[model samples]
Structure formats: structure tokens, C-alpha cells
Target: MIKTAILVDGAFYRKRAYTLFGDISPAERAKELSAYCHRHIKDEKEGACLYRVFYYDCPPMNKQVYHPLLKRAINLGQSEDYVWANDFFKELKHQRKFALRLGRLAEEQAHFNIKPDVMKKILSGVKTIDELEEKDFSLSVTQKGVDMRIGVDISSLSFKKQVDRIILISGDSDFVPAAKNARREGIDFILDPMRSPIRDDLYEHIDGIRTKAPKLEKQNVT
Candidate 1:
């Protein structure tokens, strides 16, 4: 059996899952993720054995931030998002052959920005700037070290001959460099964009493209 390692971009997977499978509980989501990875193992040629599932993400921000529209500081640690993230991480820890690799949020550089749709409405005169509310804005934060960690893991797996195939579950092209290096080291690099459209240039770096998850007919409004 061929040894296969699945690398997942946590933020990308969560967004895609929410869009395609609806808003599920943390435990359900973790199960769903494991099932998704297992599909690849089943579909591989000559049979594929699971090496590990590396999930990369940043921990939720747990600091108080001033909301300009609300005119008050909000305790992020007390928010539903923080609770959900912690619960999700806990549940992921129980998954077989799963490894959670977490990066840190750049809290000092965090700020708020108007939601894309809200900003478009304001720009098109559909809504006025004065009518903006707290809901119109979202806290924007950057994740640090996720890409570097992924690259390091890929290089390690390739150089050490740990896995015969590497499946990356992300739409980001930033992984092209790592993918190229892995392929040079004789690893079959597969890209799973979850049926999302990818650039033509990406075809050269990967051995194949595959997504086992089926798209939902009616997406949940959450």
C-alpha cells in the first residue's frame, strides 16, 4: 500500500465546508473532515495507507478589541467564535492519524474592516456610510507561520521518504514552491481544491487534482 499524507488548510476547509455542507457542530465537523480524508485513501490506485492528516490553522484571537461602531471593547475570549474554535480543536485531537499544527494570530496587527458586501453597497450608494452598524464590520486578523510550517512539513516528509504521496487540501497557490520541491524528491503531489476553480499555472506543479466531497444542492444560510 502506498503511504499517503493529507495536508489541510484549516481556514480554507472550514469556509468551504460551511458553504458546501452547512453549519455543523464541532464534533460533526471533525468527523466530516476525517471522512473526507479517508475518501482519498480509498480512491488511490494500488491501495493507499494513511500516513497522517496535518491540519494547519491559527488559534482564535482571545483578546479584547475596541469596536468602533459599538463604542466599546468586546471580549473575544467570551465570544461564540472563540468557544467554537476551542471545541473544534479539542474534537480534532481525537481523530485517528490526525496532527493539528497551529500558528499564532498577529494580534497586534489586527484591525476591523467593513464587510465586502457592505463596502460594495456603500460604494454603489445602496447604503450610506452613516448607516453602518457593528454587524457591517468584521475583525480582520493575519495568520503567521502557517505557510512556513506547511513547507517545512512537506520538505521533511519528502526528504525522509516518509510518504509516497502528498495531498494538499488548499486552494492557495503559495504552496507551489513546496509542491515543486516535493515532486523533485519523487513524491506524488496531488492538489485537492474541494472543487474550487484553480489557476492554469497550478497544473504544472501537481501530479493530479481530486476532490471527494460532493457539492450541496441547497447551501445553508449561516
Candidate 2:
């Protein structure tokens, strides 16, 4: 019987899950992922059993802020974002077979940058520089220690021969080296992109790719 390990990139899964599964709650999403993963394992190998599921994510960004456009003070630490994230994390942690590994967001300056379309409009005089809206600027939050943790864990598992197969649910190419090394160590690496488009080079490193299909809702009989 093959022992299978599943690694989920939480941020990627959250975003893609909404697109693929429609407007489902975070708890519902987590439940579906866990169920789907186990089913996939059983279907792939006749007697395969799940080793563990690793979930990687960062705690919600809780920062004090003021919007320049509205001249309003906002406490992100007390907002809906903060509440929902805490709830979501708690739900995942309560799952029996899940292991949650968290990374963190670094404190950085949120500099202003115009959107590409806005810049083009300014150049063409369709909109003046003064006409730019607050939406044109986006605050970029940098993630710290995520990729490092992933690489380290993969290396640790591969070297110890902990599992026969590793399935990573991520679309980022940063994992190429780790994937190659895992394959070299004779661990079958499979990728579950969950319907996202994968990079061309990623194809060469993985043994297979698969995703769980979303079920459609039935219409009410009238």
C-alpha cells in the first residue's frame, strides 16, 4: 500500500477554491478538500492510505490604517478580515488528519503605485494625473518564510523516506528544485493544481497531475 502525503498552499487554495467551487464558506471548503484528497488517494492506488495533510498559510494581516481618499481611520486588527481569518484557521486546526504550518507577513511600507491602465490614461489625456482614484494604488504585502518552510519540509520528508508519494497543491514554480530532488530520492511527486494553469517547465518534474471536479447543483423540481 502506498503512503501519500498532501501539501496545500492555503492562500492559493483559498483563491482558486472560490473560483472553482462558487461562494462556499471556508469551513465547507476545507471539508471538501480533505474529503476529495482522501478519495483521490484511494482511487489512484488500490490500497493507498493517507500519511498526513500539511496546510501552509499566514495569519491574517492585522494593521492600523487610514485611507487617504476618505480621510478615515480603519483598524484592520478589528475588521472582518481579522475575524474571518481567525475562524478559518481554527476550523482547519480542528480537523483530525490536518497539520497547519504558518508563515508570517513582514512589516513594510505600503508605497503608492499607479495601475497600468491609469498610467496609460494619463499619458493619453483621457484622465489627468489628478483624476486618479484610490483604486489605482494597491498595497503590496510581502510574504516571509513560506517558500523556505516548504523546501525544508520536502527535503526532510524525502531524506527520511517518510512517504511514497508527495502531492503538492500549488501553482508556483519556486518548488521546481524541491520537486526534482524528491523525484531523485524515488518519491513519486504529483501536482494537484485544482484547475489552475501550470507552467510548462513544471510538467517535466512531476510524475502526474490531477484535480477533483466540482459537483453542480441540481435545479429545483417545479
Candidate 3:
């Protein structure tokens, strides 16, 4: 029984899930997420026990508006414009839509000013000739709290010897320091990026790295 704990960033997982699959079921998502951890168990730790899965996410500020808006924002299917003969401006248009929806949500729900702040941060200093672009603000919101939660949890678990191995399912670099500290304390740390490409820096430092199997892609559960 390999003792493993999975710390998942809910927002990261949800966005990736939607990208890889049309829609994701909670049950299936949990199953897939856990299974990915199981596969990446170090060969020597065959009987390690899986301790728990910790999922961190902000409660939907406006569930009614966020989901549909995010979906539309991410999907921008454009055909090749024979007139301009350029690659479909997919990411550009998608971000524009995302920014617009974020702005709407902010206005309606008294949340962050999605449009103005997003522009200030990601789309700043763009000239009139520049093509449209989108900015990723999801990570920005999660930066302070979520990273803290993950770090504290990992440290607590390691100090208490809660599990032999701890697995994190996120691509963010903020966890690197925590993971490094965990390694220094003799707790095995593994990185699971769900479906996103795991960066070399993260991969090199972890005791193990596992990605979702191709079978997960076939499930089409999202």
C-alpha cells in the first residue's frame, strides 16, 4: 500500500480538464486524478499507501456566469481567412472573449475588475497593429492563498510523517520551494501535471513525475 497524498489545484485541473475533454464529471475526474498518482508511484514503493487528496480552489464567485463564460472564452474556432491567409487567431480571439466575460462577471458580482486589470497586466503597451491576445488571471488569484495552503499542508504532512510520498497535481512553479523543502526532510515528492507539459525544472527536482495516461484521453469524460 503506497501512502500517497494528492494536492490538486482545482482551478488548474478544471481548466485543463475542459481543454482535454468537452465536460468532466466529478466522479470521473477524481478517479482519473487518483489513478494518475497510482501509476507514477516509484517502482520501489510498490506497497505505499495513498493517504489523501487535497483539492484547493476558490469557491465560484458567480457559478451562474463563470462556467459558461469560461467555456466560450476558451473556445475560439476560426477558419483560415483566405483574405489574410494567416493562422486562425484562436488564442487571441479566445482571450478577448475571456476578458470580456471576466469583465462582465466582475461588474455583476463585485469581484475583481476583470477587464481593466487584465489589460493592465497582460495586454499592456500593445500597439494598434498588434493582434488581440488573452491573459490568464486564474493563476493570479490562486497565487497567495492556494500556494500557501499547499505549502503548509505539505510541510505539515512531512513533519508529521503523514505519508511516505506526497504528490501534487499542478504545473505552477510556486510549489517548487515547498517540494524542495519536503525532499530535504526525506519525504518523497512527486509531480503530476494532469495533462499539461511538466516543466523540466519541476521534473528534475521531483522524486517522480507522472502524467495522465493516453487512456484518460480516450475516456472523453470531460
- Per-model TM-score, in order, reads 0.95, 0.83, 0.57
Give candidate 1 misplaced runs (Cα > 4 Å). Answer: 216-222
**lDDT over C-alpha atoms for residue 86 of model 2:** 81
lDDT of 2 by residue, 1-222 (tens): 889888888888877777666666668876877886787687875578888998888887777556565456556688676777788888888776899889997745533456777778889889986776778754456678788888888888898999998989888888889999999999999888876778887899899888775533434111
Best by TM-score: 1
Q: What range of 10 consecutive residues in model 2 has the weakest lDDT sum?
A: 213-222
RMSD after CA superposition, every candidate: 2.0, 5.1, 12.9
**Which candidate comes out best when scored by lDDT?**
1
| 1-222: candidate 3 lDDT, tens digit per residue | 657777776567666766665464544555554455455554444666556667665433322223222443321123111111111122213321111011111224432223554456455565321332333323122233666788888898888888878878787888888888889889888776765666676776789876663435555433
Q: Where does candidate 3 have its weakest 10-residue lDDT segment? A: 96-105
The Cα error of candidate 2 at residue 131, in Å, is 7.4
lDDT of model 2 at position 140: 56
Candidate 2: segments with Cα more than 4 A from true spot = 66-68, 71-73, 110-139, 213-222
lDDT (C-alpha, whole model) for all candidates = 0.93, 0.79, 0.56
Task: Estimate the TM-score for candidate 3.
Answer: 0.57
Selected candidate, larger TM-score, 2 vs 3:
2
**RMSD value for candidate 3:** 12.9
Report lDDT (Cα) of residue 6, candidate 3.
70
Error of 2 at 137 (Å): 5.9
